[model samples]
Target: MIGTSISRWSMTYFAMALAWLLAALVMMVAGIGYPAADLATPNTLVLVHVVCIGWLSLAMCGALFQFVPVLVAKPLFSEKWELPALALLSAGLVLLLAGFLSLGGRLPPALWLLPLGAVMLVGGFGLVVVDLGLTAWLRPAGPARFVLVGLASLCATAAFGAVFAFALAGCAGSAGEVILAEGIPLHAVAGLGGWLTLTAMGVSYRLLAMFMLSPDVDDQQSRWTLAAGAFAVAVTVAGGALAVGFASGLNVVLSISAILGLASAVLYGRDISGMFRLRKRRHLELNMRMATLSFASLAGTGLLGIALVSIDAFTEQIGAFAFLAIFGWLSGLVLAKLYKIVAFLTWLETYGPVMGRAPTPRVQDLVAEGRATKWFVIYYAAVWIGTVTLLIAEPNTFRIAAVAMIVGVVGIAREIVRIRRLADVAGPQRLPIGTVMPHLLYANP
Candidate 1:
């Protein structure tokens, strides 16, 4: 029963991710300079939102909704609320995207809709967090605790994002720009480093153990990683704001916090390595393959940051590293995970009952990696080239990069379609929910 629920959730996430990816493909083909402008002109910010909110956040929410209960060995507190929560989030995302695109450069009337939609999404997240917290009390599992902390980080990230949304909607004071510029980095830090990374790490701890057939490590390692990650993000983001604002002593503080952030990543990488090294599975599946790719990207991004900082290139090109980390490393991991997760879910929900009674396809049977690998490779390669091009060439780089993104979108969309067809099989394997999956699966990742 738990597996079935999780499978459904995973499907929802994959479907939404498809739609998001498609939208991004359209935008990239339409062409807009990078660095992702919003108020100045609709730039990559729109793309970024599509990926972050529409793709990553939506997918994460769905995955968590299903996985949280299992982690705590409890049924969902409000199973009835699940569909409504998913609907609200999906609707909100559509409204937000509509509002942003319609607004173009200047704030549009539809812009206010983003916050309203966001509010609904946040409410849903809050409910899940509350339920998960309650479950933790009953279960006493280490993953539950980690998930709770990750939820806390998500709340903080959402709060910061809400501030920006309110400011954008003209509900706040003239400090909107200040709020965006200052609060946004914090939001990113919390979302990426704090919420997403922490949760992924925690989940990986359990999932890796299960799949890799490895013994569990001490929870203290994860706990410390979580603590250090959260603290470093908070400090670095805050200090960065001060530095941007030209406050005295901010540079020193920011530098210290940045160092801490780097340290946290190092610890995370070390822990992940331990898991991989101990993995019993000799031949990793597609999901594991993607995960390996993401890890490599993460390490590469870290190295790039070091190079940029050492040469003091950040002042000249702020996004040079951000582009790679967000689109390349973080989003890459998210996409790779989505691939395996979707297939796993499909196999379970559609085929679990028929297990042993019928010839069931392994999760790998759903999608051909041979066909999909090219796209993944193209996507990441283009991203790499785009990053370097943007750093060296500036405005013109987006054009070529945008084209690369389009190619990626097409490739990913094809893979998603292939996965969707698996549910179309007749007999007991039919998905109870229906055949159509959400079409919003795009983003550079």
Candidate 2:
């Protein structure tokens, strides 16, 4: 059964990650971090790390533990390491945040925690990467290839982040300055574009087709999209490294990378459109409907990146672009997918075993869709409004929008918790023969 294949500790990690996300949003809304602060300030840095490392990375790792087996048709290499990895990552993130907070003062003890935290975080991620890599390698598939590459990118991103930690702690020499100057942008690109976005693309390629009852997308267009995206990320990383090691011709290389990235983004958009057109499900679920916004935001972010580079306005536009890419695209997609995934996983855990023995509610029956839909709508709307206000340099409007987004997030979180406790509401209901499950209603398209 699917439940047997699922990892035991994944939900624990997911719950913690969601809490971190909500906390970060609350901090932003209260003017204690992010939108109210300059991009280079410690408060902004703290917010970025919390969202990227504490929230997104943790969530994605938990998902990988649960879904990689489904994608590659094999079990995970080691579920035993999940708890240790979680402990290390959680402790490391706390230390890292503390280090950033104490940067304003000459606290050597706090500064020392930066590298220590880096080690723990990298070690935690390393263990998962090895486990997942081995599992993917056992039965290589198209989607597995993307996931492997993404894991490599995650390692590279973490390595660069470690260097940045030491540099920020005043431990790196002149070389550190060069890395600080050139590597920061590269770090963001690799983490957001290469690791997170690429991984999401690969996972979506499989999940979307399955959930929508669409045919497998093993076409030439899909291969081209993957190839183009890989090339774009490689060139961007190489160019950034070269700029840091040898301070010459930064503009030319960055421009080329930007153009290639734009091309990759176009190909990805086309691929997604093709998937939707081929889908057999006439009425899309709320999660799929919300996912469209994320796809659009990704395309918009790419176009904005290209424009910013072309006009030599990278410095001025980086903050807004980062916001759109992180909050508007990545976080938005995660929330949308979680709307379905949480209920699906909860069903597998609570009801999968008793399916034939007794009557059980369908996965969709666990969700309160009428109540949850408005939360997603409000969240995405607030995100767009906040992004626009930030771009226009209006702090007050952005804070107001952030508050609305926080409320939306809290609402969705509440719904997810309710879904987990479904037995309290519906108890058990019997269904007659030939009854179809809501999630699999379009299974035979």
Candidate 3:
């Protein structure tokens, strides 16, 4: 399904990614030879929103629009929502980013738009959540439940983000302080660890099987892995909150929950790797390649946490930890998948009707992979370099890394636009077989 609505999702994700990249570029130029701030600057904060909500969230939404229908054997509840959602999301992101940049400077009143836009953006997510949730419940099987859990995590993420948004607006009081101290961190944990990561796992389960040409892995092991993973996220997140609020035996509770979380990770790793080992296809596709890297990053982050904790280095290098989890692992997977997805979508809309009977186009025909490979390489390289640079507190290095990311962003945007044009063509090639098709359409085909 990652590759199903390839064009629509591609256009969405790339547009967002490009926005994020531009934001990053702005910060890079503005902060040149300046000290890297403690937390992300207003500029960087805006970029963060653009990346997480604008880029990633939109990508997921577009994919679900196409994926859910196939899973349930029904079209979307409303195609009309698509264009509106896209426009609202894009505009909201712009306003939100503008607000953050303004807040960075003199904390202007215009920053109000940030929250206003955020509300609209969240509304967009809410629409998707309600629609997807209803559909998920209707079928109530396959990967939909995992999708539901992921959606639940996303809701939690948005609520927590709203708290941060309020904080940005200077509206936070004692309640806001409490959330930042306790609720905010927990929100991030649930958002990234629970929402994004869980969704990735759930999607990977179905997608890995499809790309590998294997039978559906709807078995006890698969069920347990997913269930245990979700349970671990709930318990750990709740326990962390209780520990923070009550201020009693917090360390012990957290430690125990950490172990459970680790165990769940181990189980999921085993299951996903087993899928790869038992793969029916001899070679991996681009999506699987990126997905494998994601799993590896996920496991590696867990191991790194263990190391940091063992050596009492956790407090000192916490920023590095966040960087690896979010940028290194999660961003890597997203970028990789985006490459394949855009091309896949382009093929579908432009070419799917002609797939079965004729000498149909292979998925690879949509993009010249050689041209795209450098960006992927550079992006990941920047992630690792940036991680080390952040570790050592070097501004110049950080700027260079940021620049590299921007370059990668431009590359991605170019591909996305290319795909969109291909998808927009309506012609005989797009028409179904055995029809007295319009002659005008045949020329393009």
Candidate 4:
């Protein structure tokens, strides 16, 4: 599972993502976003884009940079570009958020920021897509295939986002106007459902199997999950495009999309359960145990999503549903996996060379699982609390829950930092004073 080479820029990506996540949480706790402002306003869009693009996108990209290589059993096409990609993305996000503030009349006239930032974002994401797409093409099997599908979704999401930004900046004609009026839901579906969810499903299939010592799940159930999920996203995009152009026959089309997505979610859940049933590890680790809760969140989101879409209340309830899917499902899964991935990568970097010559610590030895469980408990509890407050229209209570959730995030983040610093490696397993720690520039011999 840890057989592949570690990514050089992944730690940088992780650090930036954590910073964005913390920033978003702080902004929420300060009443900049939902619970403090209306969901459709610029204030809330700031938080949504921050979480979706800045936090979730960065974190997922970091994971894929490392594991996509593993999934395909090939080297990354251009690892050198990763840092530049991050730079462009970070700068672009700052400008985009600024533009959003300008749009809200919270800043001076700066409409130019919108289109410029969107261009940079598109450029940044495009480089990574090209790199990973080439790598997957070389050996697209198993989870890499699913990742490939997710990359396509990423393309569509970015396209829709670009159109929306141009419309906001008054740089586009009727086409961009249509996107501004009718394309936000399409963008959300392409992003949250297609890119994020599909990529998560693909990578998680491998990660869960690897961590649990379960047999590889590239079988029929897994294939069906990918097919249905990909088609659901494709249909959503097509239907959304039709609505943007013609604005007719979308309810039926979206219903079809919703049904396909629901089916995919169910099948994916079944795949996860099957993985657990067949695991050879026997004992579940802390990350794996927490993943069960994340899975439950996914199930709840799918069911709730169908009801909302069926009753034509999705837009009305988007706030609460997005909260559940984003924080509870996607964020939860990313955090849980980060727990294992950071430790594993650290173990490889620190212990691999001296494995035979020294009594190095096992990957698990580097983790203080007991220390992290409480933080996870706090995190999920806060998520539900925040979700309930939103449903009940209790902004103040939601802010309170946001405070608790941020504490959980900060605690978990501290744990990750500790692991990176080798704080838990003790006794006979401790390294000598002169041992050279791994650096981004260090190449494996």
Indicate which candidate wins on TM-score.
Answer: 4
TM-score of 2: 0.92
The regions of model 4 sitting more than 4 angstroms off are: 1-3, 307-313, 432-435, 439-445
Candidate 4: residue pairs that collide: none
Candidate 2 lDDT at 433 equals 43
**TM-scores across all candidates?**
0.83, 0.92, 0.83, 0.96
Q: Arrange candidates, best lDDT first.
A: 4, 2, 1, 3
Across residues 332-445, which tens digit of lDDT does each residue of candidate 2 receive?
Answer: 888888778877876776566567877777777878788889998898899888878977889889888888998898998888777665623463352334433323211111
**What's model 1's lDDT at 370?**
77
**Candidate-wise lDDT, in order:** 0.67, 0.80, 0.65, 0.87
**Over the stretch 1-445, how does candidate 1's per-residue lDDT look in tens digits?**
3343442344656677667766765665565424544323445556767777777776676667666776777766765565566676677666666556655754555777757866866776666567556656677566666677677778877777676767777776756567665566567777877777777777767766766667675678766776677677667566665665664444566567667777878888888888878878878766677677777778877888788889988656666677777677767776777666666665665566557665655666677887788778877787778778767855456666768766875777667666756633455434433333323332111
**TM-score (C-alpha, index-matched) for candidate 1:** 0.83
Give residue 397's lDDT in candidate 4 (0 to 100). 90
Q: Is candidate 3 or candidate 4 better by TM-score?
A: 4
For model 2, the superposed segments whose C-alpha errors exceed 4 Å read 1-4, 106-109, 306-312, 423-427, 430-445
lDDT of 4 by residue, 262-351 (tens): 898998888889889999999999999988889988888887777877898887887999899999999999999988988888888777
Per-residue lDDT of candidate 3, residues 333-442 (tens digit)? 77667666566655555555555665544566555566767776676677677767876878788778878877876786676565545433334443345322222111
